[model samples]
Target: MKLNVAALLALSVPCFAQQDPNAVEAGRLVFRMSCAGCHGLHATGGRGGPDLTRGTYSTGDADKDLFSVISNGVPGTEMPSFRGALEDANISRLVAYVRSLSHAGAVPVKGDRTAGEKLFWGKGSCGQCHRVGMRGTAIGPDLTRAGKQRSLAYLRESVVAPDADLTPGYATIVVVTRDGAKITGVEKGFDNFSARLIDLSGRYYSFLKDDVKSMEREYRSVMPSNYGRMFSANDLDDLLAYLASLGGER
Candidate 1:
């Protein structure tokens, strides 16, 4: 969606003016000349950097926090320090400008929880593994509070690519018994002699190596990967919004 950059800047400018007029203007000029190329014309973000608008860095961030990061830059990354080039005051102004961009009350996308509920239970079939608000099976971890623990970006990636980052206890595996019976479960342990499996029933089964057939381990996720195709962008957004709202009751 196209952003109202002028309005955003106009709303943010007065706050900085109260702090330092010259610094704010100078920072604006510097941003236009230097940072605009990488951070976009509106400082929203670009190919090189993350979106500063929706990010967590802005709210309650101290001036010194900004200075340290900007001056020293991030280690082991492409981000570079401006300690030598930009003066302290100039850096502070830049920091102020960046801070001004932070708007906590920004409106989030309105999503439909009713449609999301239908998809979650019916077509999505997400309940097979993931549980929401005490409903569904418990093959995977409870997602009733996932929105509080994870970011929107994290949720998006997780849905689009399930195996991208496997949570510690949720990794699925296949176990072969000594009697040649193959069982699938969340892996508990493995050795030459035996392997342990935790099935959806929360039962842990141990298999002896001598009697087992070939046990297989899959790195891919058990969560289905058709969420992107199944739901519309708005549907996904609403579903994510619902998931995000699941936490905070406690």
Candidate 2:
């Protein structure tokens, strides 16, 4: 008879420790050993994987569902099956570790999203760098699906502290051409042979290493960092609520 993956997953459920005294540590080890590279060491996100700690993952949050996905892997994605890669006991521990991430950094967002939308497009000046539903510029990261993929904590940190966590490939840069021309922009692409940059004015530039005089990587983000001081407590909360409602189930 054909077996159900969910049923099979359930059979192993009881094998997991009830209190799971060692589950978290074991799982942490499992995550580091097997899942961290792509998912990110902190599970915040990585070049190859979306933030696993947040978002509506292909593998649902249920224990059985998570187990099946980890063991069988999601189809049409880089997440490969670990059924043979990890022992069943370790897989159980891995699940516990992943589950803990959800609570590690919870965002306490509360406010009116409707008013927040007005603030985002009008007073906030957020549309200049970020995009939402094809309405804003593409200078910065898009917020169209941010709510679905990002945790409230991440979103909150992004606004008030723009430079706190610069997304990969979006770091600000200053490049000096061999001709003594100084050009600055956020990095849009990079490889061993070349680099691509896009300025705040929507201008794009690509340069070969040999063609440039110098390249200075700036740790500070171009996005304004005084939002925490500009907006009131309620305003910040409202803005977070608005961004958080942008994606996930319409």
Candidate 3:
């Protein structure tokens, strides 16, 4: 007996339904088959892969966004394409699972503005690169009006994993001098003969092509790494909450 075209197509569909995968189970399977060798069996990366549970990628990633990356694979990295290896539905399920693993919690703790203010200035060192209420350094952008621009979640990611999403005018450049000196600074300007750098000291330095050896531009962020480990969980939550409260206060 011959089947109709629609019937044949229906038959071709995989037995698995489109229901969201059991987060834990999907993560377990993904970790075992594809990610385990490089990333440890529990998603803690090994030699070839960075730890997914504790790194920048963990705290800042969104579900759909992670799914795309997992499916498409980053170019020029050790990460390989899983497009054909896993079906699209399965990829979505995997993303959900990864998100489940990274979810610190659904609700952020209520913050103490007074304590947050102290930490922001004293312990967090946020002022080193950010400006608040006309105070603090200008090495980074002014955060006096941050609440107007970003959500609490976005602000949280900015603190814990600033590099995951680079804001404009904030890209950093690395320069290697002819004298074997290396300098990295925010990009001020560039032409064939000259390049300008704005260092952490908020000083702008100009360099001529003849005096420079090599220069490289990184598309990623220049913010210091390992910021996630710098603060206790509550500290991170309070800081994010405080940042979210800014601008709207006035």
Clashing pairs in 3: none
Candidate 3 structure quality by residue, lDDT tens digits, 1-250: 2324344233333333224334446545766788777665666444345445532352136655677778887666567889999877566656655666556443433776667778888888879878888788877777886643444555677778888767666788778998899888877777677778788877778888888998766766767766689888878777766775575244
Best-to-worst order by TM-score is 2, 1, 3
| Per-model TM against the reference | 0.54, 0.65, 0.53
Each prediction's whole-model lDDT (CA): 0.66, 0.76, 0.66
Alpha-carbon shift of residue 15 in model 2 (angstroms): 7.8
Best model number under lDDT: 2
Single out the weakest 10-residue window by summed lDDT for candidate 1. 9-18
Q: Compose the digit string of candidate 1's lDDT tens values, residues 71-124.
A: 887665445778888766667778777766765443353677677767777877
Minimum summed lDDT over a 10-residue window in model 3 is located at 8-17
Off by over 4 Å in 3: 1-109, 191-193, 248-250
TM-score, prediction 3: 0.53
Provide the global lDDT of candidate 3 against the true structure: 0.66
Pairs of colliding residues, candidate 1: 177-212, 178-211, 178-212
> Where in model 2 is the C-alpha error above 4 Å?
1-61, 72-81, 93-108, 176-182, 190-195, 208-214, 246-250
In TM-score terms, which candidate is top? 2
C-alpha lDDT of residue 163 in model 1: 86
